[model samples]
Target chain A: MTVNRQIHLVSRPQGEPSAANFKLVEAAVPALTEGQVLVRNHYLSLDPYMRGRMNEGKSYAAPQPLDAVMIGGTVGEVVDSKNDHFKVGDKVVGMGGWQEYQLVDANQRGVLQKVDTTHIPLSAYLGAVGMPGVTGWYGLVKIIDPKPGETVVVSAASGAVGGAVGQLAKARGARAVGLAGGPDKCRQVVEELGFDACIDYKQHPDVKSLSTALKEACPKGIDGYFENVGGIILDAVMLRANAFSRIAMCGMISGYNGEPIPMQYPQLILSNRMKIEGFIVSEHMEVWPEALKELGTLVATGKFKYRETVADGIASAPEAFLGLLKGKNFGKQLVKLI
Target chain B: MTVNRQIHLVSRPQGEPSAANFKLVEAAVPALTEGQVLVRNHYLSLDPYMRGRMNEGKSYAAPQPLDAVMIGGTVGEVVDSKNDHFKVGDKVVGMGGWQEYQLVDANQRGVLQKVDTTHIPLSAYLGAVGMPGVTGWYGLVKIIDPKPGETVVVSAASGAVGGAVGQLAKARGARAVGLAGGPDKCRQVVEELGFDACIDYKQHPDVKSLSTALKEACPKGIDGYFENVGGIILDAVMLRANAFSRIAMCGMISGYNGEPIPMQYPQLILSNRMKIEGFIVSEHMEVWPEALKELGTLVATGKFKYRETVADGIASAPEAFLGLLKGKNFGKQLVKLI
Candidate 1:
C-alpha cells in the first residue's frame, strides 16, 4: 500500500494565512473503488482564491473545515486505474487536493493528451493553457464583448489571467492597456504581450494619476474594463468609463488581503450608462470545449504564450499561495512534487 | 417686451445649497431673433438631479456657471413665435431654465398636447407622464427586465422615479419591495403604489436589519434592483442579489447631499454573478413613444397613478429642490408659476 502525505487545514485564517494554518500529515492510501483511479500528483495549483476557502466565511465556495485537507487542482499521472476510462500511464488533471497521492473518481479526471513539448511546455496547461487562460479568454470575449476599435483595460496585466486577457484583446484588434504592480511586469506586458500601453500602479501614488495615465493611454476612455484587482483602480476606471462601457468583474485580489471595501461609484455608473457583470468560468462549462479547443490551438501554433512560477515540493505550496496573493508570482504559481 | 425674472446661480454650493447660493434677478427680455420663440414659463420642474448641475464639476451635463440662469425643464406658453412649428398660445415643454419668460429656439421645444385636466391633471405630464415617468419605465422594462414572479427592490420608492418603477414592476407581476426614508412614505408605497413590501429605512437604524427584513419579505432572493439611493442601502441589497440579478441604476439620492461615497460590496457581485447597468433616459429616446403610449393608457385606465407635491411660486423652487434632496417630497416635486 502506498502512503499519501497531505497538507491539512490546522486552523482558519483571520487575515493572511501562515505556515501554522496548515499541518502536513501522512496516511496510508486506501484501495481504489470500482470507479476510481489512483493519481500521483506532479504539480499543484496555488491560486489567490484558495485564501478565501481557507477562511470561515460566506463566499462563492464552501470554506475548508478545520483539520480537513487543503483543496486545490492538481496535474497528476494515473499510477493505478480500477476504472476503464483512465489507464495506468495516462496523464490527467483534476481536483486532487494538496496531497502527494489521491484516489479520485474516473469521472472527475480530465485526460491530458501528450503533446510535443518543443512547441509549448506541459506547464502551459496550468498557466495560459489552463483554467486561468480560459478565464481571461471567456471573461473578455463572452462577458466584455469588446468591439474592434474599442479600448480594453485589464488589471494584473502581467499575471496569468490579465496577460491572457490583454493578449486576447490585442488579437481581436482592440486597443489593450494593462495595469501591473511593477515596472518590469509593465514592460513585459507591453513588450511580450503586445499591449498598447502598461501602467505601473505601484509607482502611481494615487488613483487620480492612474486615471490620468489611463485616459492618456486610451484617449477614447475605457470601453471594456477587465477587472482583476478591484479597489482604487476600479474606482478610477469607473470615473473614466465611456458611455456603454462593459466591465467584466473577474477577481478582486486587492481586497482579498483584508482591506476595507472601497466606496461604490454609483454616480459614475449612472452617468456613463455602463454595464458591469460578474462571471465564473464554471458557469459556462457547456461552451468550454470550444474555448479550450481554440486556446489549445493558439498555444500549439505559438500564437499564445504563458509563464509559470513553480515552487519546489509540497512544503512550499502555502508560501507560493501567499506569494501569489502578494503578487510575487510573475504568472501562475504552482508547486511541483518529485 | 415681457421682462423675465430669472433665478441665477450666485455661487456653487459646497455640500447642500441654501438660499444664499441663488439670486433672483429681473432682466429685460431680449428681442426674439430669427428662429427664436418668446415663451412665458407656466410650470417649472424641480428635480434632485438639478443639484449636480448647480456645481462647477464634470457631470453628464455642463455645470451651471456663476451668474447664469439655473437650468431646468419647464412647461411654458409660447407668447410669440418666430418659427413655424409653434404659434402663440401653444403650450410646450422645453429647457427654459428657472425663469418667468425666456427666448427659445422652436427646435428645442416639445409641443405639449392639450388634455382634459379633470381626468388627469396637466401637471401629471411634467411628473408621472413626463421625464420621471419615462425614467422609471425605461429603466424597468429595458434595463432591469424584471421577470414575472421575481422579487424586485426599489430605493426611494415613494418618490417620482422610484414610485413609478415600483408600480411598473408590480404591473409586470414581480414582487416589489420599496425602500423609503419615512413611515408615511413606506405606507404609501405599500398601500397606494401596490408594492409587495415596504421598508422604512429611517426607523430600521441599520441596513443589515433592513436587509434581513428585505430577505424575509422577498423569501425568494432579489432578481432586479432599481437603485435611486446609492449608499449603505445599495451595499446591503447587493449582498442579497441572486445569480443573474440585474440592478438598474436610476439615481443616488443618498450620496447627492455630498456625503462621502459608501463602501461597495463588490465581492457579493462576483459571488452572485450579477449584472448592474446604468442608463440615462435621453439615450433611449427612440423607444420613448412606446413607453409613453403605455404609460398614458395606464393613467387613463387609472391603473397607474401619480402624486405631485407642488411648491407654489418660482421663488420656492430652490427650497423644493432642497426638500427633494432631503427626501421630504412624498412624490414628484413641482414649482407652479400660476
Candidate 2:
C-alpha cells in the first residue's frame, strides 16, 4: 500500500476562489482490482472552465461537488496495472483529478488513452495537444468555418485555446487577430504565435475605445470570431464585424466571477446578419479522434507551439487557479503533481 | 396622362419621425414603355423595418434616399401594362414606394409579382399572407425550427410578425407565448392569435419583474424565442432560456428610436449553449415561394388570423408609421390609398 496525496474542495467560493477553499489531504492508495490500472499523475491542468465548476449555480457542466477531489485533466504514467490493455511504465492521459494517483477502470470509455510522448512532451497532453487545443480546433473548424483571406479574431490570445486558434487560423490562410490583457501578452500573441495583429485590451479604457482599436487592427472587418473571453471584448468584436459573420462562443471567463457582463450591441447581430453559437467540446465526442490526430500532427511539427505557467507540487494548484482567474498566468496553467 | 399623388421624404428625422418629414406632391404618372407596367397603388404596408431604412447609417438594406418617395411594400392594381404577362385590373405586389402610382419593368427581379387574391383578400398580401407573414415564417421555420411540444416566446405579440410567429408555432404543435405592451394587446395575443399565454410587459415595470413573470409563465423554460422587440423583453427571456435554446432575432423596434438597449445576461447564452441568428428574409429569396405558399394556405384556411390598423390615405402614412414604431398599432399597420 502507498500513501496518495489529494486535494479536496473544502468550501464553495463566493466570488473568486482562494486557497482556503481547498484542502490538501493524504490517504492510502486503493489496491488495483482486475480491470483497474493505477496512474501516477505527473501534471494537473488548471483551466478557466474549472472556475465555473467551482460555482454553485448551473453552467455548461455540473458544479464540482464540495469535499470531493478537485476535478482536472492529468498526464501520467501507469505505475501498476491488472488490466490487459495498460501495462506498467506506459504513459497515459485521463481525468485523474488533482491527485498524485488515480485508479481508473480500463474498460471505461474516454477514461484512459495510451499516450506516445516520443515527439512531444507528456505535459503537452494536458494543454495545446489535448482538450484546449481540440477546443480551438472544433470551434474554428466546425462552427466558424472561416474561409481563406477572411479575418478571424480570438480573445485571450496568449492563453492555450486562443494561441491555438490564432495559429490554426493562420495555417488555414485566414488573417488572425488577437485580444490579450497586457502589452507583453499582446506582443507574444503577434510575434510568437504568428497572429497578424494583437490588441492589448488593458490599453483601452472602455468598449468604445477597444472597438476603435479592433477597427484599426482588423482593417478588413472580422468575418469569423473565436470567443474565449466574453464581456467588453465580445461587444467590441460585434461593433467591428462585417455582414454575415460567425462567432463561436467557447468560454466567458470574464463573467465566471459572478459579475454581470452586459452585451451592448445585440442589434448588431441582426444588422450584420451574424450567427453566434455556444458549444462545449466534451459533449461532442465524435470530433475527438479527428481533432486529436490533427492537433497531434501540428504539435509534432514546429508549426504549432505553446507555453506553460507551471507551479511546482500539487499543493500550489489552488493558488495557481486563483492566479489564472485574475489573468496572471500567461499561457496554460498547470500544477506539477509528481 | 394620370395625376399621381406621392409622399416624398422631405427631411430625415433626428429621433422619432414626425409628419413634417414627409410632403405630398402631385405629379403626372410616367407613360408605360415597352416591357413596363403602370401600377395604381391600393394599399401600402407600414412595418418596423422601414424605420431602419429612414436612418442615415447602414442597415441591412440601403438608406431611404433624401427627397425621394418613402420606400415600402405595396399591393396595387396594374392599371396599364406594356408587358404580355400583366393586364389591367390585375392585382400585384411589389416595392411600390409610398406613392399613388409606380411604373416598373416586368423582367426586373423583386420588382413585382402577380398575386392571386381570389381566395384571400388583396390586403392580406400586405399582412398575414405577405412580407410581414413571410418574415415570421423565415424566422420561425428556418432559424428557430422548434420541435413539437417545445415552447416559443415572441415579443411584440400583437404586431404582424409576432402574431404570425405564434400561429406558426401552434401549427407546428409547440406552445406559443407572447409579450405585448398592454393588457389589451396581451389579451388579443392569447385570444385572437391563439397563443398559450401573453405577458403584459407594461404591467411588470422592469426586466427583473418581467423575468419573474416569464419564469412563472414558462415552467419548462423557453426552448425557442422570436425576438421582435429588443431591450427589457430580450433581457427577461435570456434569464429563462433552457439549455440549447434557439433565438431568431427578427427585429428590435424598441431600439429604433436610438436608445441604447443592453442585454443583461449574455453569459446565459454560453451557460445554456444557445444559438442566436439574425437574418433578413429578402436576402434569402429562395425560401419565398415555399414560405408564401404555406402562409397563404394558413391565412386562406383561417388557421392563421391577422388584424390591421388602417390609416385613411397616403397623407396619414407618416403618422401611422411613427405610431407603429411606438407599438401603438395593435397588428399589421397599413395605409389605404385606393
Candidate 3:
C-alpha cells in the first residue's frame, strides 16, 4: 500500500502513440508534509488533449516532460490531511496525473477542492462538473451563443464535451444535431444524449457525403457549430453553415497525429460572413462556477446523461488513452485505480 | 447634351476580365419627370468590388447584370432637377453607375444625396469619404477593434480601403504594419500612409519567406489582421498571428478568379485561438453616418492622404479596371466621365 505505481512518458511519438512510448515504475509514497495532504487516486481521466502534451510542439500548455507521470485530471479520496480544508475520506478533484496516489500541497490555490458526490457519483466529478464540462459550456454559451430555434451541430457527439454542448443547446431551445464515428455511438448520441439528430460519419467519410447527411439532419442549415474533430468534419459543416453562422473551435483531434488538415474552402467564411473563434477553457476561470453548478444539478437529477469507459488499473491507462484518441471509447474514458 | 455614353457588361469573364467583356453604348437622355434629378457624373469609382460583380458566382453583392450599365459609386454635379431637395449645379454623391449621366428618383431613400464640397473636394467624395472609407472603418473600428499598443496588419496597404485601415489603426494607438505588392507601393504605405512598417510581399512569394518578413516587421506578432488579398498573404499572416487575434475578412481578391485557395494551416486558428469574422460594409448601414463624418473631416483637413489613377474617359474603364485587378493601379482607380 506504501508503494505508488505510476506511468511515465518515456518518448514522444512521431505520429500515433504506441506502448513503447510509456513506462511503468513503482516508488514509495513519501510522508505528508505540514501543509501537504496524501490522496489515493480512484480514477484518472484519459482525454485526446493528452495526445498534444505528448508532442514537443508549442501549444496552449507546456509539453509533458519525459520520464514524468503523465499529466491528467484525477478524482481521489484524501487518506491523510495536514490542512483543515480537506478532511480524511473526503473525495476531491485535482490534477493528480496518471498515478495510483497523489501528494497535494493543500495550501496551494486551485490544487485540490472537495466535491459533493451525495447525488452525483464520485467518478463523475472527474467527468461532468469538471474541466471537460466547463470547456463545452464556454464554447457554446460564450462563443456560439446560438439563438432559440437555431440549429447547432457538434462533432464527436458521443464524447463528454460534445454531449454537454448538444444538451446545453437543446436546453436553450435550439436544434441540436450531432456527428459521431460509428452507427452505435451515433445511436447513443440521439437516443441517450437526446440530440435531435445524429449522423454516422463513418458511413460518409468524405466532405460532400457528410455534408449531405448534415443538411438532411438540419433542414434549416447549421447556425452554430462546436468543432471537436477537424478536417473533413469541419469542411462538411462549413458547407452547410448558414449566413452569419458561429463556429466555436474546441479540439482538433482529427489532426492531433500531425497531418496537415487545411480548410478546403476558407472563402466560404468570407462569402457566408461567419464568425469562427478558438478558445482554451482554463483561460476562462470565471465561467467554471456557473457551468459546474448547472452541470452538477442536471447530472445529479438525471436530466443530463453521460456514459463512461473505465479501464481497470493505472497500467491500462496508456492503452485507454490510445483508444480514446482512436475513438474506441464510447464516452468519457477513465482509468479506475481503486 | 442629349446623348449618354455608358460602359456595359456584355459578357462575364471566364477568369480574368479583358476588353472583350465590356461594350460602349450610347443612349438618349430621357425627359425629367416628378421626383427626378439628372446628374452629369464627373468621376466613376473603379473599385475592386466592381470586379466581383463581373462574375456570375455568388458573392457579398449581386452580379453585374449583362447588357446593363455597370454598377458603381459616382460623384457629380446635378444638371437638372424636378425634386425640391436637389437643384441644378449641386454637387452630389450617388450610385450613378458607369455612365456620363444618371437619372435618379430623389424621392427614393439612399438614391441621391446632396454634398457641401466646402472643405472636402467633389472627387474626394468617391474615394475617402465614400464606401471604401466606410469599409475600412467597419473592419478596423468594429471588427478588428485593436486595443492601444496592439499590432495590426493590413494587406494591399496602398489601396483605398487598406490605406484607411492602417491610418485608423494608428489613430487608435495601435502599431500598424502593412503588406503591399511592390517597392513603390510599399514606400508610399510607410512614408505617406504612416504605417509603422511595410513589407513588400512581391519579394517573398511563399508563405515561409513572407512569414519571416512579417516576423521582422511585427516583433510582437500580429494582433489584428485586415484581410484584402487572400491565399498566400492570408497563409503568411496566419503564421504570425498571436493568440486571440481578431481577423476581419473584408476581401479575398486573390481567389476572385475562381481557384481553390485553401487555408494551408487551418489548425493554427485553433492553436492560436484566433477570431476570424467576415463582413460586408454595405450590410452595416448604421455605421455609415459616423464613419463618413470622421472621414469627411480627416480628408478635408488634409490629415488623411489619398492617390487616384484616373483613366482618360469612360471608354478606358474596362482596361483600367482590368489593370486594377492585376495590381497595376497606384491607389484608388477611377474613370473620368466628363
Q: Which residue pairs come into collision in candidate 1?
A: none
C-alpha positional error of residue B231 in candidate 3 after TM-score superposition, expressed in Å: 0.5
- Highest DockQ, which number? 3
TM-score against native, each model = 0.91, 0.97, 0.98
Give candidate 3 misplaced runs (Cα > 4 Å). Answer: none
Worst 10 residues of 3 chain B by lDDT: B53-62
Order the numbered candidates by lDDT, best leading. Answer: 3, 2, 1
Q: Please give, for residues A1-338, the per-residue lDDT of candidate 3 as tens digits.
A: 49999999999998989989999999899988889999999999998888999999788789999999999999999999898888899999999999999999989999998988899998888777788888889999999998999999999899988999999999999999998989999999999999999999999978899989988999999999999999999999999989999999999997999999999999889889999999889899998999999999899899998999999999999888888888999888899999
Going through the candidates in order, state the TM-score of chain A alone for each one: 0.94, 0.98, 0.99
Best by TM-score: 3
Q: Quantify all predictions' global Cα lDDT against the true fold.
A: 0.82, 0.90, 0.92
Per prediction, fnat is 0.72, 0.86, 0.92
DockQ, prediction 1:
0.59
Residue B231 CA displacement from its true place in model 1, Å: 2.1
Clashes of 3: 0
Error of 3 at A242 (Å): 0.9
Tally clashes: model 1. 0
